[model samples]
Target: MDTGFFAPLLTGYEWQLSLYAAVGIAAVTLIGKYLVLLIPAFRAEHARNAAMRRSKMTKPHYAQNQRWNRRWGPVFLIAIFVGVLPFCLTAGSQPWWQMLLDIAAILLVYDFFYYLVHRFLFHDGGLLGGPLMWVHAVHHRQHNPCRQDSSYIHPIEVALGLGLYAGTIFGLSRVLGDFHVVTVVLTWVAFSQINLHNHDLWETDRFPFRYLATMSRMHHNHHARFTGGNFATITLLYDWLFGTLDHGHGYGKTKVAIRARSDASGIKKPPAEAGG
Candidate 1:
């Protein structure tokens, strides 16, 4: 895991060039994501959902919090950019095929780590109370999140989550040698698209990349109904491995069933429903 290879590659203007390329790649990836929304079916679906959200807006505090979160969007982006800057400058010495493999490994590791932190740390109310719980509660306020809500999160939660991602990448680089700048950029681009798409209301199951729909459904379930399961961000591998994969019916169709089960068990209704 000698990272010496990156020393020569990143010297002089090479690191700056790599950073510029990463920014270009990221911009293209974002444009592609917006293009997906231009699809007729997706456009109509988003419009309908937006209307519904407006009609059902009963919580003034939720709107206020979202506005507050929106103000911090630039801060979150800066954190992500700064966190990934180092990885973007390093260049791997491996061949193209090997570099691809290493990139896959990094993404897999990231998803696995994210699943653990999200499930055990972020979502675990018993372990994290007071301000921490309140931070997570803000994100959960949007039962069915739209594009705007995708990045709406408490700053503390953002720092913790991004810190874990950066730490994982940096730690892996030490053990696996310098990862290629291309690999790092591509991985981040894919992650950004997948994360945003998952938060959106679009159903992508019928798309050519079937897995996009699967991941989206899993994340949607986490937000809509089964909050305890489906914790993985880009893939369900960790969730399946951990036996937390909940492929039950969609939230809309299963609300009655969930309510019935809660009532039968003598458990109180969820805060979302209770407040609604």
Candidate 2:
């Protein structure tokens, strides 16, 4: 009953079974994120165009997003492994719920780090200014991003995910305990999937599931202006708590833009250019 004590929560479960379960969760979550967000978001765009009897959303541009993803997706996926696998290996013998909570706390910590890295480091002329900025710019260049396009990130940024999350687990486990590491890894895997789903276009009314809707809208706006607002990857609490959320940018506007991209070439033209 010692709250301060750190120990593995699972003893009856076989190590092999635990390893398999962790891998299975990672696989299912990965596929779920891609299919749920990218596929539906893409389909929604197509449906919108078809309903309007217009074919402005060209297949080539749509495919372009896919191409970028295909070329780079594996690398990004590797980051997931780099980030979660080691931690899982070290701490897979914990209570499932404890693992889940650890994952959540890790995600929150990493998300905040992401926000800081994104806002100050990526934006400012700091260490991330040169390489990270260039890589991320490819993403920003996509004015009207497809749902799947959300996966597009500079390899540099992708690398950070691996380092920040994995490195955190390593450092924390040394101080906290081995079982806690597994918990955090599982949580991160779940979070990675959630982030993927939220970024891609898929309608949902679920448990706010990490506040996906709010975060998705914020990211959409970031794409909207090609800059600014909604920096947090996992939760809006950071932005909301830190006075960074753009309340004026209503969800209505975001929906319109999303629908419009769906109806058009799947490429979002600048608002000014669209007007002219």
Query: What are the runs in model 1 whose C-alpha is more than 4 Å off?
Result: 1-18, 34-67, 76-84, 91-94, 125-131, 204-210, 225-227, 249-276
Worst 10 residues of 1 by lDDT: 267-276
Any idea what lDDT model 1 has? 0.65
User: Candidate 1, 216: how far from true, in Å?
Assistant: 2.4
Give per-residue CA lDDT, model 1, range 1-276, as digits (tens): 786876664453344645564586777777875996787766665675576456445467656656676677557666545545555345536688977887788789989888777776766523443335567676776666765556567767777766766676667877887666777677777776677777756664565646655666667667764244677887888877867776543232244566677789786564433111
Q: Give lDDT per model, in order.
A: 0.65, 0.55
Query: For each predicted model, how many residue pairs clash, with residues at least 3 apart or on different chains?
Result: 0, 5
Query: Per-prediction RMSD in angstroms?
Result: 6.3, 9.9
- Per-residue alpha-carbon lDDT of model 2 for 1-276, expressed as tens digits? 774343443332235534554576677666764675465544564354244222222456545554666777577555545444444345335667766666666677778887777766665323455435665665676544434455555556666765776666555556555544345435656666556644544344356443555555566666655335566777787877765564424233454664577568665433431200
Local lDDT at 35 for model 2: 77
Model 1 collision count: 0
Worst 10 residues of 2 by lDDT: 267-276
